[model samples]
Target: MTDTLTTLRAQLLASVAVIDEALKAVPPEAVQLDLPKPAAFFDRLRGRLWPRMSVSQVQGCERILAACGHAGFGLAWTAYVLATAYHESGYRMQPIKELGGDAYLSKYDTGRLAERLGNTPEADGDGVLYAGRGDVMITGLDNYVRATVELRRLGIIGEDVDLAKTPERVLEPAISAAILIYGMRDGWFTGRGLDDLLPRTGSATVGQFTKARPIVNSMDKAAPIAGYAIDFQAALFAGGWA
Candidate 1:
């Protein structure tokens, strides 16, 4: 038994080392991009989308983009992340329930939605509580628990904070950004990473944007999200970031 435990420990350490080496291989340029000011970003995206975002929310959005870029995401990936946030948060730059928020809560309080979301029949109210949060709308009990564990592992959230129990914490910009980038890149949210959606084959393309819907939410609102990605790409180019 002791030997078996030792072998498992060695394997875990080796896995960690492999991840560290992979992170080191990311080029500095890949993780760095010129970010636009909040006002500039707002001006460029206003009327077209994010009509409800305040200047502070715009700043939060810029911060999320810069954080993703600095974490080794390229332009296309960053734009997709932005577009996902735009749709998930209703262009507010904060976590929010889907349209018909209360209705979603009430309906999903039980029934098929609850079951599909991994809310056991005994775990009453789980559906409404863990509906969706964060930039990518981390939904369901399983995802909330996973997010809490992963964020704790990344030191982005305290060990004592159970995101499953307190879904509101997912609304914080820094926390949401960390969860968004990590979840999307690592396939924790949808079992589909950015690479699964948009391959890193040189430059960005319109096709990639159109195809990124399944990476986040299914086909729902995919067209608008794709349009937002295109808009973001154009904005990035104009800002000299792309």
Candidate 2:
């Protein structure tokens, strides 16, 4: 067990090194290719949900953005993603279970949540097992299955790691980042992609930004999330990333 833990730690360090190298390689002309310093990021998040963003969490966000850029996400997509994370995790930079997660599990054990998430009536513990998790709050059996399949296909998670079975794995920073990025970009979370609201041109009016609420939740915190997106965009612009 100790050996396994050691190996995992070594692998994590190697992954961090790789991300650092990649960030270094980013060309100056790339749109908003830089990450905010940890101090700056935390200061911006002060009095917000996650004022104490950890060094590791900031690194995770940076690595995720770097990977997204490599995958063709530009300034707009990056800002939108940051906003989504801000809303979902309150800038915590980690996968967090939904507020009232226990209540949600109990309430949805065999009700609407179960049905919507593809949990059969006989799947007694499905709701509790697959309740909302991850940076983007992947909820339900169907979404978990989709996340597992897509992450596997993208080579983000290993074949040995069954995210559907081990939903907690969604909290792993790299894995969660991949899930958030791919899910939002490809509409895996819902049938609505960022492009549906923001457009490929990376421009979004107020109405269109608000429309992105459906991409994560059903307009629950649409206005606030959109406002967060606006703040993120302005920060990106100030940093010459947008």
Candidate 3:
């Protein structure tokens, strides 16, 4: 038993050393996004999709790229994520609260949807309070609870954080990028994940991109998002995608 313990200790030390080497091999700049053709790529979307592009949009894209960090999501999945963010936030590319303010957001406070969302109808104003927030627009008490768990499970947030109570924390660019990245990757929004629609081995075709709408929403504006994904894929390749 003493010999076994000594062997186990040596194995763990070796494993940790290998992990340290692997981490060192991937420098910080390895994750930083340097768009090779920002003018030729995103500029195409400038007047056509977004009225005007800003530094915040570029920062948001970089945040997502950093959060992704060699996840083997491939160019297709990466582009799809960018497309989802584009459509979901109306091309703002930043975390945004759902429009319509309190009155419109109150819709989540009533009916069966409210029950599923863990909303207390006509009490506490949880619908408006925890209303859709983030690049992925994580909405409702139920989603907040789930996002909090996912964020914490991935070590992106502290155990002291409770998203349902402080939903606005999702607005932070890093937090928002994490939510969008893992939310779609893990299927937090719907039962369908990125791998579900676009398998790891298979390439994402135009039709597949349209079908991938379920990864976030249920076929809402599928066509336009697909178009965006195709365009975004070009940008990813320009950035030296593997």
How do all models score by TM-score? 0.76, 0.75, 0.80
Encode model 1's per-residue lDDT on 1-242: one tens digit a residue. 99999999999999999998986985443344466543465567777775565766665576676777667676688778888887777677666555556666655566787777777765466766877777778777888889889888887788788988778887766778888888888788678788888855334677777777777766777777888888876666556554
lDDT of 2 by residue, 1-242 (tens): 99999999999999999998996875433325355453454456545535465776665566566656656776677767878887788666667877775655765568676788877777477777787787788888888889989988987677898888788888876678788888998889768887777765555655667888887777888887777777665555555453
Tens digits of per-residue lDDT for model 3 on 51-141?
Answer: 7778877666766666665455677888899899988888778899998878887788787878888787665687788788889888888
Model 3 TM-score on a 0 to 1 scale: 0.80
TM-score of 2: 0.75
Model 1 residue 105 lDDT score: 66
Error in Å for residue 44 of model 1? 3.6
Candidate 2 residue spans exceeding 4 A from truth:
1-57, 101-103
lDDT of each: 0.73, 0.73, 0.80
lDDT sort, best first: 3, 1, 2
| Candidate number with the higher TM-score (2 or 3) | 3
Give the lDDT of residue 221 in candidate 1. Answer: 79
- Scanning candidate 2 in windows of ten residues, the lowest lDDT window is 27-36
